[model samples]
Target chain A: MLAPLLAVLGACSQSDESITEQTKSAVTQTTTVTADGPPRLEDGSVNLGPPPGSMGFWTANNGRLVNDPNNYEAARREMNSRVNIEDAPLQPWTLALTNYRQDTFIASEPYTRCKPAGGPRQIMSPYGFEIVQMPEMERVYILTVSNAMSYRTIYMDGREHPAEILRPTYLGHSIGHWEGDTLVIDTVGFSERSWTNRDGLPTTDKLHLTERLTRSSLNDMDYTFTIDDPGAYTAPWTSGFGVEWNADQEVFEYMCQENNISPAAMVGEGRLSIIVP
Target chain B: MKKQYIQCRLITVTAVLAAFYAPYVLAHHPVSAKFDTTQSVTLTGRVTEVDWANPHTHIFMSVEDKSGAVKNWAIELESPIELEWGGWRPDTLAIGAVITVEGPLARNGTGQIWANSIIKEDGNSVFDLPDNILESQLGSRVEGPAPRWPDGHPRLGSEPGQSGYWSVPSQHSLVESGVSVAMDKHGILANIEDAASVAPFQDWARDLYVIRQQNFMKDDPLFLYCIPPGGPRMFQVPYGVQFLEQPIHQRVTVLMGGGNSNWRLIHLDGREQIGQVTGNDNNPLFFGRGLGRWEGDSFVVDSNGFNESFWFSNGGLPHTSQLHLIERFTRVDLNTLQYEVTIDDPGAYTREWKSAWTLLWVANKDLPDHYCQDNRP
Candidate 1:
């Protein structure tokens, strides 16, 4: 019995050291900010939840998928990006729609109308969010505190996306797995109504996203995603940003549909602002 | 051979580790984390105000301490639903009525106490629970030990290798636990006169309920906005409910398969309830915040903080933010989940009331893919 227990402990110790080294390397490469090392699960996986007595949720102010220096200053202020839109490989029609959406100040955004925030927009809209990993049921829930108080379930137990989704939903179907300390999520089958980005980035029915989430430190989480859609962009593109961990905060109730006056009011200033009257 | 041996050893070690944590997990009762149950206090005072609302009903009392200084103490009790079932009326303790309350004090050191019992100046209990109050059992009791987790706690979710959900409750409408009122599958009363029997509603709430029944619920917010069936209405809906329990996470997710794919979370961990505001600055919710604990085989959930957008239950029952709910989910057998709820909303109902019902566990099937949007008018 002692021998078996020693062997199991040895295996876990090696895995723990590997995760620590990899996390250190990634943090050192990105920024000089020292990490207070995040809490770990029994198996050495970074525990995204509140560590023991402390409680918190992840907060991301900028949900921008791309960094376009030439874009309007207002848009730049809201989005912290890793890749420039010029290198995002946007198609002609998609680029035109994105420009139009930016020009109109995103007034007609469906999310403001209390629609569900789909795809990457789930992580982008930021009041606070929690990644609840329930291994017992082989499910991980990403609960967002804002927008429609939306939540998405990612199947962690080796299950493929359904071959046919009768009705595409706002959240779509997601499957996730662990690569060392990073939680890699692959999602597909999203509704066409919701945008993938707050800047009105459009997505077709063919949108496939591979997102990576890593709790790099107690105070920081690295979120990156690669978008692949034949109907929207010329080629697959990747971009990312860091989400801050908000201590002593939990996901609160946010009823978006209650007395929402945006849909009726957002008329884009009668289109004269764009036509230059 | 070495790989297989390592795999065998790994299972043995995992089992041992799991055993070590089982006792501690089972012994945890963080349910009353909001209040310090150890410290007990008894106070006698005159009622100043009765804030009859959803999440909780706070009875403010003016008590003169030893120094002869009158201080207002907020006495908290079960939600309006539970209080109604306990025979508490909206005017049970009117303004300036002298009463004594005994309960534990709040941990926050505020002048607040979670009332255990209340007595009037006449030495009578304020709660007047009816003798007829009983569990509404259905489909014959299946006598069998319910499935349990390794930690010895009853399992609310599906048993291993089986997929099932709670559906097709015994009672379809929200009638008083003992009152036998006739209503359709949609909670439309066969005789509008029976509206008085459904629940002890305030004059205005009963009037609104009658108007809704008269118009055949054409103005139902659930139908108009595709809103979630909040409160006890989640069970009254068509497709039933599913329990996703994550003991490690110290929470349970109750998913409603009937109305717009809605779900509510109940935290089993001992965390103090806090204020909630949406990013858009909206307060209050349809499901409200829930804190739960396991009392033997029964899982008791205390929920509060509801908004008035949707009905508390079917038949157009109204509620306010002051609505408080105490719901009990007990898995009596492999195929039965007993659900009991106490509604204490002084804003809508004249007294606190309760409704008890049981839901059958539909085995070897998933929740039907039903959404209000798909069948909305």
Candidate 2:
């Protein structure tokens, strides 16, 4: 027993030495190419170009334009990790329509007249987004194409919610946890004010969504989302995909009002006349 | 045999080395180096703390830089609502608590740094668990507004004489003839579809709709039993709303009138979702659950997961757990916020529907301190 224990100890030391050596080699290799090129910026900042595109934001699929499919499962994974479209299949309906088609849909009578977007499909559309992360408060902020922004707090302290009834909203309330490297988010407290999609799919305030995001590779992530709202559907449904990281991108100030045609027409703008005939 | 042993040892060593370095390589990529990544600056300073509740929290500290110039650096933190849920008490970081802070420096040169970790002078870190604190301190400049709602907005529900007129436009299309209005400006209603329109039901939805219709025609026990109106309805009540802007921290505070009525804090910090539970069983009497973000000039809000103890709308629309709503309030003009709400609850309707209206921001007005306790109808 003593002999085997000694052998194990020797192996452990050997492993530690190897690790140290490998680290030294890595540092040496990395430093060898050091030509301190440009002076650092005053802000100590690096520009991250156009934000990495998510599969949901893809402009085309297999050389065809499409709408973002409600692939909740894939979205959950991609949101949590590095996003890459090449690794995952082009989800169904992802290329159903182009940005032009989406504009047309918004211009159509049902939507123009203030109809609900269809159920289970609205959240996945490719649009502008702002992703805000607050590590101190354990919260994440998401502003999507629909001009909806959600603030989700990650409960780092092991505390439960208080006892009482709640008011509801469109994006619902979300809480998240880190499972290994992946972040798992559970959302509920949805209001009846939102449809599942632009086509008017339905859901109740009981809507609950569980999303898992995992960075599968350096530049890509997998997102998986499961939706369960007993009041609307027969059963829970799952969907999702990959999102590619665009490191050199900043979340632009997405001002919907600057080019908003929806409100203009809804409040009786002349644009409706062009489409109505 | 000696050669074979050496080869085996090499392979073993290489594998172990790779295994040990894989995490470090993955963690220390260029992305990690971009945002003042590893260096931490700990600041020890006076409280100068401002409790600007939701969206984000702000604390300003007077720190002496390397040049010995005492500059007021602004530190942004999370809202009190989030902190409370995280077991943070009101006095956790008191007005006079000399604390240490750690965070990344700002991308813009404003002496401001995003706080990564905050420690008390007692050597106790405020948020050590969950690795919430990003770094420790080095004296750096902090900037941004200490959170405070701009004062002088009229309090909600303060108007004296004229009965308040709260109108919710009919959600049905003009083609659909039925028109229903709320019984009282403060009372509830849930308008079901015309009986002829209810179809394509898979039995359960049909039955639930029938029960809901019956509940609506009769006096809802929820209202009689003094149960609070649940989720989406809480905001629909036509009441004066007030806006509190904290420019320094880029946060907004919206105070509404109705029930005991609650306020919503919109954080302008460049932070996204942290995994905090969305719903609470307690505080159900308050605003159900609020998650808000800004998209350009509009503020979009999604709320739900309410106790079924309330009505769906003032028009008597009934709902089950499936009630999910998406609301968009776009300030089209300075005084008008185009409010659009889409209602989708399979338990209540055969198909999803939507409604559109405008919320006129009463400018130059003060929110009246209207308490629901005095008018317990």
Candidate 3:
């Protein structure tokens, strides 16, 4: 199934090395992007971690996520709200709260307070993250280098989310399964503690994330999700972004709580100055 | 007169003292800079109060100097956790028990001293001496040969078809092997005068360690800000740990159940440990750079490049960026894992020191989910 996508990329001139190297160079030069098929486990599932005996992690190109993928770069830099606002089904109160959050330039984000980046924000935070799949333990872990260097566990052992989550927390209950080459994850039971995106989108305990991760090539992964939060939005909506794989790098220790001073002085008003790039 | 009446009176008095005991938040500072270590003070006083808490434990005493004027003095000691590991109970120091203390005096002439040792009037110390307490057994009593992987290497992790983790080590602290110095599980010396005997510490490192002990370990980054117990401290903590050996990846993942669910990766691909960058960003790692290889049946790991933000061990053992650790994991039996680590930090120690202990295998269970944030002070 992935061979067809590899065909669309291009013919490989060199079999001496992995195709991810070629794709990385093409991405840096802003040239025609081409990718080779991703490595796989013996069971034919995508090897989320570095291919055996190698070290690497996924680095999201789009730092600020939004419903509209086209405005990712613009929103990340200038907080540009193009098609995202109109597409979102935010409730009236949530829209007002989002505006208030944006007005303050998100200085008081939970991430700034040395709290968990939570949800989509985890990938959006600076530094890279790794997806470790433990087949023997029937568990998958998403370990991040940012935001107190925390990790989230996703059960892959045919387990259901508890009927009730007694204590709501950041990075709530996650259950994942492999769908062919794509890894699908369902997350719920979040507290109303963090924004859904860097743009200050609202979230509630009702937030349910149906996320799909497809590694089309060795160097690139396509991430998409449909967020359903009836408490904060009128209807479910979808958003997505692409993450680049760093073939030479691995995730390392990052403790954000040490000497963090931003949250205490986050008093501000009005939107940040927009760059007209 | 009945002997039972005296026992009852003691129990009633102890219960009343326990009820009235309250914790005090001592302002923590560098002991090397605040106290006069060159000068010693000896005071014979009655135990007025005891506050068992995190950061540090304190015992208030009423003492009369040569001037015959009685004054209340504050004596600092190790944290409650370390004390508990040293076999101290809440009622170990009875109120009004006459005791003698020897320690360094404060520079500011305050009625405070970093208590080095506390001796009761009965000539016994408040803590159980490591000599009196029989040393931990060399290995657990389980009867079986250790399991091995298909490659014929002793497995450091769970065997196939087994659901378990390595935990509940016989020794909860990292002390220099063969050193008879009395100390708590965190390597907090029961007598500060024996600091040099515990480890081959440089002059400044020894002073800093004494200061940390005097401050009652209140300055521990893990206790104060929930910093991950980065080094050997991970093995010394209460919560259990799990090792996921992935020969295919050529790396071993150590999952910590205590340190805020943190994990450390040890590369077994024979990669060079020097001049490595973290994700294009040169960040000093908490777990340092761990490179492992199989030496016979033992898995030996060489690690270095540790930062000074966190202590490598409990009791605030000081180490600089030049810290190097050589750790060995050998499965002595089916249920016993012998762990030995050699500290080679030239920045802190005058000579290399080694500590070895064993962890028992916990079967049919998983590592407990204990996050530092839930219990951070």
Which one is best on TM-score? Answer: 3
- Per-model CA lDDT versus the true structure: 0.67, 0.38, 0.66
Docking class of 2: incorrect
Task: Please provide, for model 2 over B1-377, each residue's C-alpha lDDT reduced to its tens digit, 9 standing for 90 to 100.
Answer: 00011100010101111211101111101111222434445566666554332223456655654555555556655433334334565456766566666664433445554455677768787732232211111112223221211342221211222112112222311111233342222221224444334333445654554554444323442222223234445445433444443333344445444322334444444444321122334212123333555665556656554445555454344556566666666654333446666666676556656666554443323232222211111
lDDT of 3 by residue, B1-377 (tens): 11111110111101111221112111122343344555566777777777553334667777764555566777776545446545687688988887787766655677776666788879988843342222221123446788888989988776664556776666655678997777655555668888767678899998998888877576677755667887787887655678888788888888876655678888887777762444112456688888899999999999887778887777787888888899999998888888899999898898889998888776645554444443121
Question: Which digits, one per residue and each the tens of the lDDT, describe model 2 over residues A1-277?
Answer: 4565456446434532322343223222211222232111122221111222311121100110112343322222324222233222322333233233343333332322222222223234232232333332233444332221122233333334334323343445556766765667776766554445432344577778787655543344455676687766556666555544433222211111112224344445554211111
TM-score of chain A of each: 0.80, 0.51, 0.78
lDDT of 3 by residue, A1-277 (tens): 4454344233212221222453345323321345578888776889888888677787764544454343222324443222357678889999888778755445456555455656677765556688888776677788887665777777787889889664455677889998889999999978665567766788898889888889987777877778899999999887777777777666666666555422223223242111000
Candidate 1: segments with Cα more than 4 A from true spot:
A1-36, A73-75, A261-277, B1-145, B160-164, B258-263, B270-282, B362-377
TM-score-best of 1 and 2: 1
| Interface RMSD, per-candidate values to 1 decimal | 17.7, 24.7, 12.6
Which regions of candidate 2 are displaced past 4 Å? A1-125, A145-162, A259-264, A267-277, B1-377
The TM-score of predicted model 3 comes to 0.69
Candidate 2 achieves a global lDDT of: 0.38
List the candidate numbers ranked by TM-score, top first. Answer: 3, 1, 2
